[model samples]
Target chain A: MKGKLNLNFLFALALLATAAVLPLFLQRTSGGKYNMIVLTYAMIWAVAASSLNLVLGYTGQACLAHGAFVGIGAYSIAIMVERVGINYWLALPLTCLLTAFVGFLIGLPSFRTRGPYFAIVTLCFNVIVYATFENWTWLSGGYAGQPITLPAALSGRLARYYFVLAFLVITLLVVRQIVKSIVGASFLSILSNEGLSEAVGISAFRYKLLSFTVSCFFAGLAGALFATASGRVDSSITSYLHSFYVLIYVLIGGVATLAGPVLGAVGLYFLLDRIKGLGEFRYVGFGVLLILIIVFFPRGLVGGLNQLRDWARERRSARSPGEEVAG
Target chain B: MSFFVNQVIIGIQLGSQYMMMALGLTLIFGILDISHFAHGHIYMVGAYLLYIFSVLLGINYWLALPLCMAALALAGVLVERLVYRPLRGTPSINTFIAAIGLLLAIETLVRGIKKDAVRVPVPVDRSVSVLGMSLEVQRIIVILGALVILLLLQWFIQRTRLGIAIEAMAQDREGASLVGINVNRISALTFAIASALAGVAAVLMAPLGSITPEMGNLLILKAFVIVVIGGLGSIKGAIAGGYILGIIEALGVAYISSTYKDVFAFALLIIILAVKPTGLFGERTAS
Candidate 1:
């Protein structure tokens, strides 16, 4: 078990090392500043998707308000910097706190429902947030969109890319720690059998609230990163469809796995980017791909790859026995 | 007083459309336990079909209306058979994802076909003054049309053999199947009938607003609110919840603030969820 854990740690470290230097590699090779921008956006989405995985993937609650939480993060930063004149870096952590409070308020009422009902409540929250963002002109800049001025340190594309990459790593590590801790165990138990867990005195409501607040915090953090990286905050960020996109990212990457959301976010974003010229027709292709993935690869890409690996190992073991018999 | 009455009257008109959509959604959820997220897109297609048959093909409005419903009913059955049937018995979330996928695909397909919204040209553009009010003739027709369809549906469900079979299956799938009811046939029928209702709603509503591919997204959101407010699987709840929502939205828009019209439905939903998770009329095990 220790050896396996060490191997997993080493793999994660290697992946993180690669990610840390990825912007430099891209700057030297492709040399297109646009590539860094896209990569940074992908990393931001990766953080958001991973946060969603905490609730939808692990805790088994299909919270669709994730987009709203991210929006809150963005708007909070936008409001603080543009309106109240706070430092951008200081505003990010504050945004996370505000989002967590909002999550707590939503989660309290949402605990009364379950399954699809919970999903709908979250969706309603999404709409409510969108309406607020649209109408509260002073805070979110309404439909005109609020432009964010990145600090000089992050004004460059490579700096923003590395900055977002660092946050993505932080998000993954924080979520992984949570997933590996006692709280994650309780979350999984609640997900697997809520009634039984409640009956056994696990206090599903409290844990669910915890999961929701924590998820929103990370999602908000991602949003702040996105706002600075993209240099704008818009009402569209809070739209329910954005929530659906993040959900798709987590699902397609493989839920319940730390690596899945990152892979899914980057992979699918690039896929959409590749077909950007198609205009609205691109969404048709995307929708078709979503259906195909859900139908054929419900466990997601990582889950499918793991299954293949296990199958290959079994085949190898079976072949070794056959060779021994032949000998 | 007249202004308040006007809003109430208009609210009822809007509620009728929501009722039509919610009725179908509740029926499907009753039997299949799937939210049928694509129902709004189905309504969008039905309106498009109405546009095609009535405007493009030059069919009579009355004839085009029924044809649109019939076509959507067939489409609904195809959706069930081709997409949902194979997904039966899987985790409910898979079907939910599939429904969302269908929503995206269908909406995008329609958008690809026509990027711009089209106005539905109906025969009556006149409004009749009644009780110090000027209500659109088409709006009255939509209300009466919704009432007639809803009544016919009630009669069919309560009296017909196939309808009784559907109710039985909805009440107890295993028991109904054991009693020799064809479960697959009934499931398909439920989907068809529900989808047909959405189509009828589309025809009724086509005259009220310009038809757009993106309209279904908001329509579905409202329909979902109605379903949850009324109770997920309760027919009577759907009817009641639909009017409640419509009236609340209208009154709120008229009296409180117009900009917050959409927020009222969600606020009511959250309150209901917190106070009574099963819904105002829901009796089922919600989880």
Candidate 2:
């Protein structure tokens, strides 16, 4: 089992490396600016969705304040670059740390609560954050959102694409490692049965806080990247609807697996952009798609695919006579 | 003293509206164990229904109120039967997504019909003076109407058979079924009652605020706060929480920055959640 898992891991890594290089090769040959732009947005969303999955899927905590964290990161980064004249690279870490601190503060109190109750608390937090961003004109530039300018060095779509792509790769690997670590096991145990986890010496409070903080950090990082990518900032970007969009992306792709969010982000983005004559109906279409996916494919797209693979393997094993299969 | 009294009155009036909306949400959460995200949209639908009856159909506002309520009640029953019933036994996330979809669809449909700019007109005259503070007649009417409805609901839930069945189901679904309570019928009725109340709230609230497709977003957030602060499934809690929120907002706006009124409710929510997770009046239950 461990050997097969290692092989699968290496294969997945090789595939990702190859895919990452393919874009550069394509850019060299075709110079597809639009494709690169879309891919960058997909990477940003993938980061956001992966962060949400840490709490929602792994810890069984539904946080609706994700977009608020994104806003915090974006606004923070925007202010650092635009107002304080800080280097973009220097501002990014500060944004992540500040967002993580805010997440810890929010999670500390609410983590003690049960499921839907915690969700409501987070919902309230989102609203408050949005309201603050809108009303606090002095800090957040009010409803207009502070204007941000990307560095001239990374102004082009392709450069922004590579920046976001690299960020996504780093965050994804960090999340993947966390999910495989002992801390990840604790999160799963806490999610599965909080009381049982407590009985088994797993401090539910500690792990919940850890996962929540880590999730918010990534969301904040994504927000910073998103701000840089858009080269514009607005309070509207931090609205509850944005948080809902991220949640939809995570759930639609497959919450349990690492690759689910990336697939979800790419698929939904393309679906929204490619669907013809359905300009304003994008939300309606997305909503219906979300409902269908949740009701039928509870484990999500990746889970569904895994079930198919399992079925095929079983059939092959049943048909084969003397094929030695390692247990 | 007079200023304080005026603030109290204003708070109570606003609280009544919040109570009306939160009551339905809390009941549905309690009875069905599902968070109905579309409740606010249903309230929006109620306002639209009032506009249709009062303006388009040329009916009087008073006559149109109950008519709209009845219609929305029926719509709620249909939604419960068709949309919610089919997805029974699914995880809470499924229902949550469904509710979001339903809300989006309803809002989109309303926008499609009204071109995203429909506003319900306020049709009321006269002002009443209480303790030297003048208040609008519409505000008085809305508060009185809310109180009457709440009292009637209280009576029905306490004294009526269907209400008792709903209570039983809310307390324990499987146990209610074991005791011969028709779960489906009660759930449907709860939806009807909740929807009808939301309709009433819409009619009254539309006069004070503009009605739009996205109006429900803020209203639903407030209702959720009220329900959480009051107690997830407690009617009395909803009422108390609503009044508390309204009063806090009123005072917070008067004393603090007016722009930060919305933040007060959320700040209170965070404080309350941190200190008392079960809410002020809610009983803690293991999931």
Candidate 3:
């Protein structure tokens, strides 16, 4: 349970508390309708980033094809609902499973290579999937935007927001339960030392594939929610750079920490979207923020705050009557 | 028959450009153990710099070419020293993320300044007949330039003390340092040389296409495909991979649909990776 908390635990807990209160906080900002919209998408992206954390953070597998999995989920649900007349709810779960199956297939070849090669292979897979989505017009509808028709039960902005929020809660609970289990410990051991874990009978390939498939399961959920909630599906979601954005979210948040990805996804999405009204400067701002954070706080924002908290704790303890000051 | 020859020639020219980029990319990977994902963006900056020097300042193209290389070399050194050097020995993912961040910053900065895609006029616009083919002089220039640069690079890496130092550093960083090699100097020099190669590539590519901030994204992706196909850290493999990809692309475009030409490269990457995970020429180190 201690895992990486020695690095960013307390700050992550604080951030989780803020996430719990984010919905009510956003609802009060009713005047900023555009901010509400941004909040909705940010939450969707948070879900995506969190699923990525399952594979990337928890399992230490850099599965860069995540955006494609999300896109598959989006397309699967959209096509099933609009073209096949399946109920949206029924279509959503089915599509998520389909996405996971595809993820397992992708992971088979990708996991053969280690580390950076793994990243590159998965990246190529992302591009390949994007190409298919773009050229196969009948299947994906390409850039024209595949239309997503939501059920009446989840219509309107507030309803959609609540719907996405409910799923986010479920996703967090699922991830938390997994993280607390022995399976999670196996993942950590793999991260800390893959050879040792494998030598001790952990079957690295099977566990990695399982981690990837489960992560894709959540990614598909987020994608389906995004498609139905946003009213469209597009190949742009599967772009290789979309996976980079998810990486940015996970890395800028604390790696291996649950609350960190959510904080990063929400904070960064809001900053670049709402605050930077200037069209071009937003990316410059983003790049600078990423560089500064990675350079100064490689452990990300939670880690930075953890350092500050510990520094203050050190100061308080030093001032106590327990020891003499040398300097 | 003439059409096929032209496709091969086109492939060669494209391969020339890719060879330069992939060589730089592989060298950086060899030395720093960093992927340097922004290598293409550095090429993108070189194109813009060429435009600024030749088109804006009215400097002659030849003069602007060297200036672009020099400026980019300096930029590469600064990047190595200020940005990436600090991230050394950390989890490679941190460095990879930093490189991506640097790429995003470079591209956004260029976009903010220029706002529109621009083209540099070809320095040599005349067309000539070569073996029953009508060829643009600029194409010959690109081919010759890349060839000369390759030879010069080969000499530098093989003959010079600094170059040998670079080779040593690439082979084993700690061992090189232990043998009295200055790690910092080699890192900067490697960055400088690699970036200068990218600059040459940019100059050659600038006349052929429009220079946009986002141009680097696809170029980098293609270069990665080429690099992976050849093998990471193998110069010969990079060259072979470049030509192979170029020919496949040219032939695919000539025979198949141009719309999915890019997909072929991605598919090739997957196929090769599936078949040989360490790369075709790679005796990869298990890091």
Give me the candidate number with maximum TM-score: 1
Candidate 1: stretches off by over 4 Å: A1-10, A28-31, A318-327
Candidate 2: regions farther than 4 A off: A1-31, A318-327, B285-287
- Candidate 3 lDDT over A3-119, as tens digits, reads 435545565556557655666666766665566777778888888999999988888877778888888888889999999999987998998899989998888877877676677
TM-score of the candidate numbered 3? 0.93
Candidate 3: list runs displaced more than 4 Å: A1-30, A307-327, B130-133, B285-287
Specify the highest-DockQ model's number.
1
Could you tell me the C-alpha RMSD of candidate 1 in Å? 2.4
Worst 10 residues of 2 chain A by lDDT: A318-327
Better of 1 and 2 by lDDT: 1
Clashes of 1: 0
For all candidates in order, state the fraction of native interface contacts they contain.
Answer: 0.69, 0.51, 0.49
Docking class of 1: medium
Interface RMSD of each: 1.5, 2.4, 2.0
Model 1, C-alpha of A181: deviation from truth (Å):
0.8
User: Which candidate, 1 or 3, has the higher DockQ?
Assistant: 1
User: Which sequence of candidate numbers ranks them by lDDT, best first?
Assistant: 1, 3, 2
DockQ of each: 0.72, 0.54, 0.52
Candidate 1 colliding pairs:
none
Model 3 pairs whose backbones collide: none
lDDT digits (tens) for residues B191-218 of candidate 3: 9998999999999889998999988887
